[model samples]
Target: MQTHARRALATFAVAATTGVLAFAVPGAAQADAGPSTVRITEWMYKNEATAGEFVELTNVGAAPVDLTGWSYAASGGGPGQVPLSAFGEVGAGESVVITEAPAATFRSQWGLDADVKIVGGVTHNIGRADDVEVYDAAGTLVDQLAYNDQGTGTVKGPRTDGVSGEPKTAAALGANDASQWRLSVAGDDDHAWAATVGGASDVGSPGTSRFGDGRDPRASDGGDGGDPGSGAGIDPHWADVRINEVSSDNGDTPVGDAIELVNTGASDVSITGWLQIDSGAAASATPFAAKLPDGTATTTIPAHGYVYFSSTKGLGSGGDGVKLYLPDGPGGTAGTLVDQVSYTAGQAGTDEGTDFGAGAFARCPDGTGDFTSVAFKSFGASNATACESPVTDPGAGGGSTLNCQPEAPRAPAPCPPPRSLPRPGPAART
Candidate 1:
């Protein structure tokens, strides 16, 4: 489905990994809170708009939750903290959004309902690999959402459905692990990227879903009115696309991470309006990484063909991952997960291009096989399989960049190296 409306909200982007948002000194973990049964459900850390970023909470429990004296702060220390005194109370099964944007502006941007309980005053900017904490009047921590690096150049955490999904719009229902977290699309699911509005790459729906896509989950004023069963707003490409190869720790080619995708189906695929999200790269900035600039060499993947994506943003050398979302035209919903691939330091050859995965992870046999470490990254071409001979370039220091530190050291060859990547084995039927 194409975007049904226009989204003007924008998220702020981190220009560089300058260690801006720091971790707060650890304190005793707090869990008990009052009557309200709430959990931190969704949040986007890449608040390129500063005001556009937000955190969503849902009352899954039976009782209404009052949050008069509650405070919102980052476990990962960032901007000033905000007290929830202004938010009044949140009814059962309802959702409320807390953001740095002025309440009116936030409401207008996401097209939220007046009764949805949108509030400003959040000085805490969500950061990569950080925690969102909510404390009660008595200073007792009620909820702490520890989100691993899902996305920033786009953000999603593990959905109850599959892979570590981005938390940008992760939907979690009462005690359930796997929930139908809606795909981030622009048509109707999420706000479409725009230079003046969301700064491109921005995808999320704060105060949108109350934990589920069922019509019943939308906020009090009446939900976004999407028909859940029909799958109205998803992009068709989501069904045929696949993330074939990703070069995150690109010390070998240091030209930046190169994402190679393939048309798994027999038809061609155009990725003009698609979104690319990065799992947090503490040392780099992925601001424009989500979308490609004008005149990119290739945006269409021919029948069973490959399109190499040269990213404007680089992946973390130590460890980082990449996510691919289906395209959404202007005002179109675009966050249907097309494919995603991630890597660790050792498995990724670490940032310096020296580790087991050799800083590159690929789908052996190109588009059909499960992803595994390859001899080296082969963008816009067939995947360099582990079964192939080892070939580290002499120009970049003879020996393979092998420093499996924090783990065991690795062999100098990508030829049949240990398969230590997380998403190993057969790829999930994404």
Candidate 2:
């Protein structure tokens, strides 16, 4: 009875449609055609990867071209793609892995560089140590991966390293020869650290690996513009919020409600302008821009990983009240602050309320205890009826504890552990 007693809040809906536009591959390109070069001949078990685990891809030129949807990025994050029917064709020279969880658990060891044999449901899981990057449809990033771990000073894989001279053979997994490597904070020749080769890393036989060079040698034009400059921008301390206590179904109404952004840090932040919901209302407000009314704008937030937003795209379905804009500053306002919530109607149960409910949306931004500070419930309720944040009221938990609940319906949580890049000692002559 008061979700909007004040009135006057309309201008913030610019997303008629903008989702299919990812393809940026460029740290080094030389060959061309349709599927004529392909690379990456080995990789079977990355020592047994288990901190967050991993698996990668790339190389569809020298005659392959069937890596399927082919997508991965995380040095700065964005474009996970890889659902090319799951995996089948991959001919020519060959090379396309992608694994960390699904692939039939390891179906006899992940298989397929040419050995063939991977036919179950075909959309497994894919996640172990994310923060990947490998666009190329037209978005253009070409290559990038680096969670942490260079060991021998610079080796995301076995691209050859007689001693950091870099160039042992296999072209170092760059230019598309997949080998599932991942390492770079600005080390090795810097192609962002290209190596990639997934499908259950047991990679032939090795002693140490993890490289994915290629951070931007000026290949330029990653397309898909919302503009964070494309360097993978980020700074609010890495942001990483969660807040979800409920309350805000009718009065003061801004529109449904929900939050969650987590990147923690490893590079790639660009929620575009940050602030999923700052209610201070206007110290400099505009913040929330991971955008997804269908316009889908999330560029990258890997590191610790997390990217949800809600207010009833499901559950009891009852939106209106999330305006955190900033896309990247230029004029739309700069967008600041960083915390807000109050969506009850149907209170996040499904329709994809960004996976709300089930409790989660509080990582602590200011809104205190129990987290997600708002209150008011009753939409189809049942996680105890949801709503928490508000105890003694230390500012009311402006935001932070990582809360997220909409009314149950959960089953999509498998990516979080990547953070280990630091071993490259020398290499900068090209």
Candidate 3:
């Protein structure tokens, strides 16, 4: 179904170049500045046979948006328009799902208590390319997305088989730019679509307002609406920090297998209670070290600062995995995984096959780029420059090691002398 309202690729390119899609309303003091009211945050036209397809809309505005006359249609206008008037209205920061699945199925799969408009019989184009358009009662185009298997606009390629299109961040520029979208990750809770419907993997956060992996824009705000020191509206989570370098194969000196972390966030992050887990072919992840062993308040990573942790356990010269967890309390728990990277033996990047390599996989663009091989390893230093020489023992030398002491050091008690004389004297007196 092709629509005449389809935007040209050239127009989107221009808009992206000029940053026009991110235009803020004059004097509008909001956290983000893209869509003012309702936006198509996520949508999935393809799914397992009985799973059903859905289009999720999010109310980004501060006030409720009436759905009295809002409608959605596919490009070429084949499936016709699905009127949302029956749902009444969507409150601020809320989401609504328009699906062909039964209400029970939709609720079970997404675990959403929000409005669900079930449109049966209408068949949306599930082909390589299609369009989703949303319009108000006044016939004004609110938002439209035209996706294709062949890279279109800012999107690099087609959506993976089971993956749904999700915004990279909450403040995504617009649906016009493919770069603003990413494949959804598995939700933290079991209520995820993947958990209910058996599939390749749970690829979208259907019910949650933000991305399921906690990559949502709101997560960056530190849970404070708009605090000054709260990362300046940026989430200081694991995604803000990158695993810049990893030395998996340190030969005999296992401690040399260090992992370098860099704070790519806008503000300093206190990693006082963070834990690093090394899962070596083990199904269960074990705590390998702590970011702040002493539990001191001074353990912080300044904005863009670098910190290296020498491995206490040997990392497989072959395939191995490492995870950074942010515990809710003093020590991390199973649910506190912040960031994870898994590499195959002799390969680079994570288990997903991204940025594959050997020796040390260092970030190409320092803190915020893809990981690649470094000619020379840099311990406790910037990854901007190529390694001049091999780093043999990252912790053994003068280089600073991440203090992994399980407890704080205490002064030894003075040895007690001649306790036997007191015991004999006490027995006699008794």
lDDT of 3 by residue, 307-378 (tens): 766665655543455655444322333223344454433332122222232357666677645445555565
How far residue 418's Cα lies from its native spot in candidate 2, in Å, is 38
- How do the residues 153-270 of candidate 2 rate in per-residue lDDT, one tens digit apiece? 2222322110111223444554332234322211122221112122111112111122222223121232211112232354443333323234333222222443444444455555
Q: Whole-model lDDT for model 3 versus the true structure? A: 0.46
Model 2 C-alpha lDDT versus the unseen true structure: 0.30
Per-residue lDDT for 97-198 in model 1, tens only?
787678777666544556668777455555434456777676666666543222222222332111112233333422222122333432233322211133
Task: List clash counts for every candidate, in order.
Answer: 32, 137, 12
Q: How high is the lDDT of residue 248 in model 1?
A: 63
- Model 3 spans with C-alpha error above 4 angstroms: 1-37, 43-54, 59-65, 73-83, 91-94, 99-131, 135-142, 148-153, 157-175, 183-242, 247-258, 263-283, 290-333, 341-359, 363-376, 386-430
* RMSD to the hidden true structure, all candidates: 13.8, 22.0, 19.5
Candidate 3 lDDT at 17 equals 36
TM-score of each: 0.47, 0.24, 0.49
Worst 10 residues of 1 by lDDT: 1-10
